[model samples]
Target: MRYWPIPLLLVALFSAQGANAEPIGFVKTLQGGNAVIRALDDSERPAAIGGELNVGDTIRTDRRASLGLTLKDDTIMSVGPDTELTLEEYLFEPARGDLKLGSRLGRGTLQYVSGSIARLQPDAVSVKTPTGTIGVRGTQFVVRVGR
Candidate 1:
């Protein structure tokens, strides 16, 4: 009976850890087919409208599938069919002037729009592909990575 409190404490600790895994963005739109999201430490799941996405998550869209996402800083991203993109890193705290965004697109196409993070610190945003990295300068751009 004395050990009962121990399990409760453990559960609380685990729950707190899970709570710290904040959502970095959400699925704003989708078309053609379903998109899948693989969390940093979780299995793949269907990305539905309004579904939350966290840092380190990988979003994959199959043929004829597309996805649109809006991040915490209002940065907009659209993934075209057969695309693989990862939210490698992100930190947005305007008050503290701490803003950073980094992502990698392995294949397919991506459309990006600048947001508060880019407006706050233009040099803090980067999108990488097999060839090289693209530095965002408070602008909108599209990229396609060939398979």
Candidate 2:
């Protein structure tokens, strides 16, 4: 009887922990120009300005618009005007010092600055675009997307 109660308690505790754990990080900042920015979750709908961005969030920009994001590792990514991008994946594990970054670039320009995590494990960071993919190596660069 004691053993049964112990197992049941453990199960309940784990279930509760899983349910309350946040999926991923939240949007720290969002800036839009003449174009627009949309966070497809909740009823907020797509607006021509700024809003919260979460994991799996997608942003579309029209004529002359820009957006910037500060990731969990304090890495900065800025998108140029008339572009669309998605936050495909953003994960970090301080325990093992592992980090991963993935995004889908529809059409636009992106500038990425490697964060501390990149310095720690440069091989683990990657960026994906329509044409191909990019692997970071302690370097800062710009990417432009076109038809």
Candidate 3:
């Protein structure tokens, strides 16, 4: 047998799977059905318990809404009412020494609880806001942006 066809087949398979790759996180809890997820493509969808979350997703909550979520690295976070946040980056591959989690909160409140990445590499986790970036060094922390 020849190896010529293997590369083409592998490329085809990976390209097909790329669009439906696993989510980075999910909506573990939601309140008042007021949270919406705006994708990088600008498509919006209502947030639901267990809803899958992806990188570049802008999570927004109305004045009466709040929600909680968990990432692939076991990181937990919750957002308060009128929140607008973006999941900017994430990479969890401990065996190969790749671990990072980053986000940007434009407004409202954010409560973040560090995960294995912080324990392994404290400098890998951060939450950026209008004022400054919160370098996650502890187990838990909270931040409030604009309002």
Candidate 4:
């Protein structure tokens, strides 16, 4: 009876829902012996200790903080003190895997060790900072971001 109105309503509903959708993934681990995770989203402010983590969710630490995360393909990454790292992208499949890690750095350090999957697909892993970008080449290194 009213096809135009129905289509417009459907589009608006879908767009609204999409706006609140959260990205999906898992939290491998929380290291440093005294680190805690805090959710920044409202849909589910779940505790993220070795649990699943989604987009729009932020993991934060106290004065003493550290974290070791194993991505979908077992890629290991360790973050240290007064730092904030966001899991921008985490994609893993049989044929290929891609991970984009972005860190505000704030005032701390981060050490990363690329996993076997990264060796096969070096382009799959990347870290972004205010200074520049760090591309993984199957090597281990530390990144410090601060004044």
Order of candidates by lDDT, top first? 1, 3, 2, 4
lDDT of each: 0.89, 0.65, 0.87, 0.59
Error of 3 at 41 (Å): 1.6
Error of 1 at 41 (Å): 1.1
Colliding pairs, model 4: 23-55
Evaluated against the true structure, the overall lDDT of model 2 is: 0.65
Q: Is candidate 1 or candidate 3 better by TM-score?
A: 1
Q: Is candidate 1 or candidate 4 better by TM-score?
A: 1
Across 1-147, the per-residue lDDT of candidate 1 in tens digits comes to 355686456656764675435577889999998789998887899989989888999999989999999998999999999999999989987776878999999999999998988998999999999999999986799999997
For model 2, where is the 10-residue window of minimal lDDT? 19-28
State how far residue 86 of model 4 sits from its true place (Å).
0.7
Best by lDDT: 1
Return the lDDT, model 2, position 99. 69
lDDT of 3 by residue, 94-120 (tens): 887988888999999999888888889
- TM-scores of the models, in the order given: 0.85, 0.69, 0.84, 0.62
lDDT of 4 by residue, 1-147 (tens): 555686456656764675423234456656554554545554434335667664444555555666666655556667776766666554544453444433334446777777655666777667777777777776788888775
Full ranking by TM-score: 1, 3, 2, 4
The ten-residue window of minimal lDDT in model 1 covers 14-23
